[model samples]
Target: MEPLAARTIPDLVRAGAVHFRDREAIVDGAVRLTYAQLGEEVNRFAAALAARGVGKGDRVALWAPNSWRWIVAALGIVTAGGVLVPLNTRFKGAEAGYILRRGGARLLLVEDGFLGNRYVESLTAAAETHESGTSDLPDIVTFDQWEEFVGGGAASGGAAGPDVTVTPDDLSDLFFTSGTTGQPKGAMLTHRQSTELYVTWSALAGLVEGDRYLLVNPCFNTFGYKAGVIACLLRGATVVPQAVFDVRETLEVVQRERITVLPGPPTLYTSMLDHPDRTRFDLSSLRVAVTGATTVPVVMIERLRDELKLRTVLTAYGLTESCGTATMCRPDDDPHTVATTCGTALPGVEVRVDGHTGEVLVRGYNVMRGYFEDPRATADAIDADGWLHTGDVGVLDERGYLRITDRLKDMFIVGGFNAYPAEIEQVLARHPAVAEVAVVGTPDERLGEVARAFVVTRGPADPGELTAYCKERLANYKVPREFVFVPELPRNASGKVLKTTLRSR
Candidate 1:
């Protein structure tokens, strides 16, 4: 496998520009930029940021949906020696505002509109109400003003080189975790750690020169940012930026672009295979598929190979703390191994399970520096020994493959989106009618698991009313799909709510 020459994300972009100058780097709708062109744009963005007083160690947030512009903004921030704080696209205004404020971003790049929502307007309003008043908040730059923003820097005629010195250990990205308990905390990762992880990921995914990648996953997530875009840059793969995951649109892109790589949760591939019009699109170009946010059905693995005819169907296991790559299935592994286990650790990573509780623990260079500005939380996550206590219950088989059995934390994934019961319960508890509540993940046919709330109300309560209350505060996925109004919650002798009983009900 070819090795990376650059240590930082900025240097990586420059390396790609030098080696794959004329090669197409990104494709978003009508916009297509070659590596050289992308490099130029990134330089201009870096200059623009410098003009705005964004310097080393400053945080810049990207709130827009997936697009070529998003990739440019991310690289540009890193190039300018700024930490990229990516906001989730599905986040409600308050949710987005919390991340922006907590990360202390000095600049924000957001889309004016997306899927009928006025993102800029909502975020602007939310920012005003945020504890870190909008007065000191990041300058919100809309997508329509993108050209002007870029032009302002060009007109200034500032030097293309970075204004401040950048080191490998300098904070590159501050990814906020959607925690199972309490509010989100920013997980800090350095440039060296991120670049190293994705380079390994690219090789594991079998990415190579001239391959076309259909990136259906959100660019904000590690799956899209690191494995999707950065991995492509490392191996000269072309990226087709997808805003949302629509089966028809995905199939069209694959057939039209001859997309060689498509990686997402199992929901993506299953939707394609189950779609009635699946055969209408020529899917022969699909070569690599990397999946696994939740459980992987054995049949899903079988169909990816037998039905889709994909050469490589890899299942990976990771969390944001681990830079999103801890273990991954190999290309040559059998379907059963791929289906049953989240393969062995990468070359330099170590994986062990707690002998008593069976919680997976990972120790590696890929681990994040710590939770930004929250050393207490950081110490809780990474113990004294340097192993990241991955709060996940799993077992290492004789062959060293890991099969995750359960999550020690009260977090569950709904349609690949994590829904923490504590977070949801916190939102629900705010309703005047709710006296007490216990939320749990109940099995679902479509989405792997969805939130189910059992509420003990002070007065007469309506599930619809409570649902709408949560919608106002939380993302749509976090809103409980099914609400059970009960007199009291089942509890243990210690007075802790027995979530297992709630799930059994």
Candidate 2:
């Protein structure tokens, strides 16, 4: 096996500038930056951050869509020895504000407009209420002023502050988990854990130099940031960042850019296969594909090889706590294994399912340090034995391949986004008409599973009224698709609501 190259994100940038100089590192819309140019911009941005009193371990929140500037800002924050707080693009004002205040972010880099929403205004208004009403909240910076933000250092000869001496254990990022119960908790990950995990991931995916990678995944998620951007940087691959995923537009990009790598959930491929004009675009350049978040149909794997002409197709499984890597299907694996299992554990990771209960337990360097500011919750997740009790149930085959059977928690995926019934129920409980609520995942043809809410009402309430109330509090994806009112919820003798019964209904 090839030895891992760099130790930190900043070191990776320096290495890329030396080896891949003059090569196109990023292509976002009309902006094309060479490795050298990217390095220069990162250095200047780091300097600008240093001038603003940002230092090691300071949190910098980034609220923006997928763009070259997002990439630059993330790298710049790491280069300056600051922790990156990535806000989900789908997050509404209150959701984003809660994270910012909890993480205590000092600076917020945001996009003024995206998908017809102005984030700066929405975030500012939300912050006014949730943010302790002090000057400690992050100072917002818009994308339009991005050039000037970096130019401040360029004007000063681009000299960043004295070396901060970051070690492997230094915190790299503070990623918040999708909380199912109440408020979300930040998962603390170190520099070495993230870099090492991605190195293993890149090797497993067979990423190579000169690969034209197309990123349709959101940059906030691990799929896009760690496996997408960081992996591309490791291999000297050209990054083609697409802000949104559209079948026709993706087909155009595949032909125009001669993209060799495409990785997304099953829905992404399904959309392409179902497109009416998929035949018109030349998708011959596509060679590698990595898909898994929701379920992967065996037919989709077959179609990828036979119909789409893709040479490599892989499926894997992971969670945010595991640095988005635990197991992956190998290149030589058969279609049956690829489709049915999440493949064997990675080189250094350990995955074992309980013999009786089938709960999956993981222990490895890839596991996060712990949840920030919530030691009790962290203890609940990772026990004293060093094993992370992933609330997922699975079974290991005779050959060591792992297949997930069920979730011990009531968490479900809504179009690849993890939705927790506890969180939704907590929000819905605020409505005057809702006396009690229980949420469960129901089957959906397109999105894999959608949330169906069961409610016990105190007064007259309609589905439309309940949905409108939820829309005001949660992200669109977390909103329930159907609402069924009942006189009371079925509960076990111990007073636990029977979610299984709710799901069955």
Candidate 3:
């Protein structure tokens, strides 16, 4: 796939309308549109935003799920020369307010009543308890009035694109951290950074023109917005949005829409395979899958190929700070390689494990400009030499395959040996009875710290049996000292296992 001629997000819309005018651009429930129609809708929304004083560099917060409207709203924000600030749907009322206040969002577009939750009301209720009160909240726009708002703005601007010039270097989106450990700091990305990266991502992931990609990932996430929606636009592929990831619902959509491209974490595949009614769904359309996490179970990759008949299953590694991508396995990579490692970095980007500590460091165009409005934090993250310290422990083999071991904070010391949970989890996941597992350190009298395996079993599994399993395969010092069975592992909306929560337990 050639690099997009248009550098900016807004210009991508313009180019798409002309090049893929007849290709299906979006599919959301009853709504379907061609690239031309999508371009028109984006133009209308941009005009409205521009009319409402959303000038260049103004921050506009968007709180919504995966949908056609969210795509248009996001594109419109950038097209109007506004910096997009996306709020996670899983965020609490207070969390939403914090991002809005911190990002200095002048306007907030929310989905209102989704899954019986009123976001605006929640934000309002949360704000009343805040020290700043409601005075700091941005103007709220609900999903119900979407048509009216767009029509009014289009009427004023008269169907022309917003009167603004967006350059490649202009800020495109402001992505904030999950704030699990502290207040979230925004990562600023320019148009060129996001556009250039995902264009390469789309190509490497085997995304092609006319492929129907079911985006189960949230639009608020880097993978969903850039790799899902924007990648589709960049590749002439169709965007099929799923608001929330439900295994059965995912199957239904795949069967109904003939979805060809499915990208998600490994948990998505596991849930689908375990569903009782999975085999009933016609999933022959699934061909390409892109998944990544702390680790990928080799068995799951085989099952996806054998049971689901997906041909191209790839693994990748990245962080939010890297614009959601750094390295990705190629389409032709073997299942074991795909399961065990994230491929080499993209061309022009550099990746190396720290010589003494094995922490992954990335320096490239895709690295975020810095943490928004926090010079100290930004300087701490990106060194003067331009290398961004990822804080992730990984191994870069001679072949350049990057194997993520664990987060530096998540590594455990058992006796005098180092234990990476991802490595242990990979071994445990091979057990027929084990569906998923997380290993964390717990204080031990003899060893100072020992690994405790939290297992979600598919079949009957005993702690004694698991201990012997680890003992036979792993070094004595690396074997988990305890095992706990649970119905499911706790995870954030983005499907990362909550190791912090597990350690607390």
Q: Pick the candidate with the highest lDDT.
A: 1
Cα RMSD to the true fold for all candidates: 1.8, 2.0, 10.9
In model 2, which residue pairs have backbone atoms overlapping below 3 Å? 180-423
Full candidate order by TM-score, most accurate first = 1, 2, 3
Distance from true location, Cα of 64 in model 2, Å = 0.7
What's each prediction's clash count?
Answer: 0, 1, 0
Taken over the whole model, the C-alpha lDDT of each candidate is: 0.86, 0.85, 0.84
How much lDDT does candidate 2 score? 0.85
Model 3 stretches with alpha carbons more than 4 Å out = 1-3, 131-135, 178-181, 410-505
How displaced is residue 478 in candidate 1, in Å? 1.0
- Taking all chains together, the TM-score of candidate 3 against the true structure is 0.81
Q: Which residue runs does candidate 2 get wrong by more than 4 Å?
A: 1-3, 131-136, 155-162
Compute the lDDT of residue 238 as modeled in candidate 3: 95
- Cα deviation of 112 in candidate 1 (Å)? 2.5
1-505 in candidate 2: lDDT tens per residue?
A: 1225786888888789878888899988789999888888888888778767789899999988888999989988988899999998878777888888888899998887888677776776666765323324578788888878876666544654326667778888888886556577888888888788888888888888889999998888866888898899888888999988888999999999999999998889999999999999999999999988777899999999999988899999888899887899999888888988999999889998989448999999999899888899899999998898888999998888889888998889887788888889988998999999999999888888999999999989999989898886677889999999999999999998999998888
